[model samples]
Target: MQKFGNATIEILKDETLSKNWYHLRNITYNYTNSKGETKTLKREAYDRGNGATILLYDPKIDSVILVRQFRVPTYVNGYHGWLLETPAGLLDGDNPADAIAREVMEETGYKLRDTRFLFKSFMSPGSVTEVLHFFAAIVDATDRVEEGGGAAHEDEDIEVVVIPLADAMKMIEDGDICDGKTIMLLQWAALNRASLTQ
Candidate 1:
């Protein structure tokens, strides 16, 4: 085992499990507790890289723009229908802001008037190394420059949906909007709608 003096955790082994699309690795590490005890642990982590998501809110209309698309993971987990969610995409090699701007244009066809950084979070910290940067943008009809169906090469068949903010909240209550990042963004919008409009 390699030494990591004064560090709480030390990576002992990081072996690639798969890299077909993203990356999966089986990692072994040594964890040192506060009590001066040490234990070895092994865990598999799926690293699809970090991502970004945004809530497109139009204050003039008191509405938000969203998308519906199929997710194979959700489908295999028993959710047969498409998922309603905020526009999001992997950062790829771009920074959070740049990546989200590209994603919003590709997914919603909205050239945002401005974007406000809300926060960031790990959608599935236990297993997936995907830190999602959340943002909110104010947009209007003029921002729509295209059909906004998603990138063709990614095989994304997305349907754009525009609805009142109230209806979106109700969708959460009725269990229709179940995506984690989308739910978080919606809640943030609901909590800050007034300030956002101003």
Candidate 2:
């Protein structure tokens, strides 16, 4: 099978949408299909920042740690005001694991040690340039969860929630979780929970 010629995108100009969380960039791309003729596509991509989601597991407790928060977009759309989600954070300038580990501790007060990458995926294959690298983390559940352990400085108002694995799965099935990263990571953990522990 013949493949398209190498495609490249050049940043002509980038406009920041949100301070650090989101950005809209104007770019020019050159793609040559089966024909050698060069085609240019000038388009805008949303730079939502690369991010990560951590599915924290505790074998002894038979549960996972999640977080509850209010999302502005959901509120505006009249969706569930409060959302059940996993520990996720944007990879500002750090690696996915480092970002997620810090997020876990900051949001849930669980200092995780061994974090193994499950996989990485494009958040929206259509237009968004954002990606989500996911991981499964193991942490002991003995630590007390202080309320509102969010990164207040960064405007994160997070509430930690501990759920039995079964309950978490139920919520997912009931259409409670809308975050893509959270859903993928939790589904991954649910399918591989036994192997994940041992």
Candidate 3:
């Protein structure tokens, strides 16, 4: 796609909205449109730092390691039960690769030695400023060094699950798996199954 000319932005006012859990800001700005029209806009942006997620595939068994946990945000938004998702966590001051490696171990007990960085995305661009890094790694039974659940002091309660790739994809179609990052990584694995084994 051809690049559209940049829109000019002038900050009018910026204020902290909240910081109980993460940082939230109310920003007012002047936006100059492509047609040379200027308009004032106000928006609230939530910043929870950044995060990382990983898909641990066991090619030997054609399965992947996943986690199930209760998410208050999703529960209030309509989902009433725990969500099945790729092992993930906030960077918490660490870089994406190191953060994901630690997260995978904590969430699934899988020690990732050859994690491949897939891509990065803004999970919710309209209101959130979190950029999530995606990764994948090939794993087997030998890689699991502990009985993974979650960090206790952080009030995390997680259940580790291993399922075949085909079943995982079917869950997505059946609405059983609704997390965006999980679905994206699963789809990527499906499309690149051959290369992943190489």
Candidate 4:
């Protein structure tokens, strides 16, 4: 391990607080060098954290569940307002499986069961330290109409979309699914959907 530039934020320029997804400090670090000289350097310092996501599924129908929401970031840049994604959230408390299960239920309103572990890796390893734990969760879709999204404090105004696993795979090719978590979950299912269908 190596230590580089270290700096503390004199003041947090912008602070956004939420019951769920929240940003704290603005501790801007030079991230240039440490007590020793280095040969290479990359990014400065920015927001970095770990998170969890789940591909909730309904074994009864052999269908997968995903959410389409108006991503402010994506909309601000370019593309459609809705981004097809798995029911996911940050592991704010560090409990991997529990965090993912909670997110799945809140975002999709389908109580998850038998959340099989899928993947654990970073989302944007380049600049963001967003690590996500992916899972294929079992959910009850019989009452999907009444059960959708978490509380308002969750900042999740999500619209649930349930489709066949095969169709989701098609969306990936047609550019409908662009998020990393969704892609990873689908890739996982493609290899093990047969054994995990129930």
Instruction: Please give the RMSD to the true structure for each candidate, in Å.
Output: 2.1, 3.4, 2.6, 5.5
- Candidate 4 lDDT tens digits, 87-184: 87777775888887677667877765577886688666664556777777666655454476655874767888889888889999999898877888
Residues 49-110 of candidate 3 have per-residue lDDT tens digits of 99999989999999989999999999889887699999999999999999998988888888
Better of 2 and 4 by TM-score: 2
Q: How close is candidate 3 to the true structure, as a TM-score?
A: 0.96
Ranking by lDDT: 3, 1, 2, 4
Scored by lDDT, the top model is 3
What RMSD value applies to candidate 4?
5.5
Each candidate's TM vs. the true structure? 0.94, 0.83, 0.96, 0.76
Candidate 3 ranges beyond 4 A from true positions:
1-6
Clash pairs, model 4 backbone: 5-33
Worst 10 residues of 2 by lDDT: 1-10
Total backbone collisions for each predicted model: 0, 0, 0, 1
Question: What C-alpha lDDT does candidate 4 achieve relative to the native structure?
Answer: 0.70
Give the alpha-carbon lDDT of every model: 0.91, 0.77, 0.92, 0.70
- Indicate the residue-level lDDT of 39 in model 3: 91
- Please give the range of 10 consecutive residues that has the lowest summed lDDT in model 3: 1-10
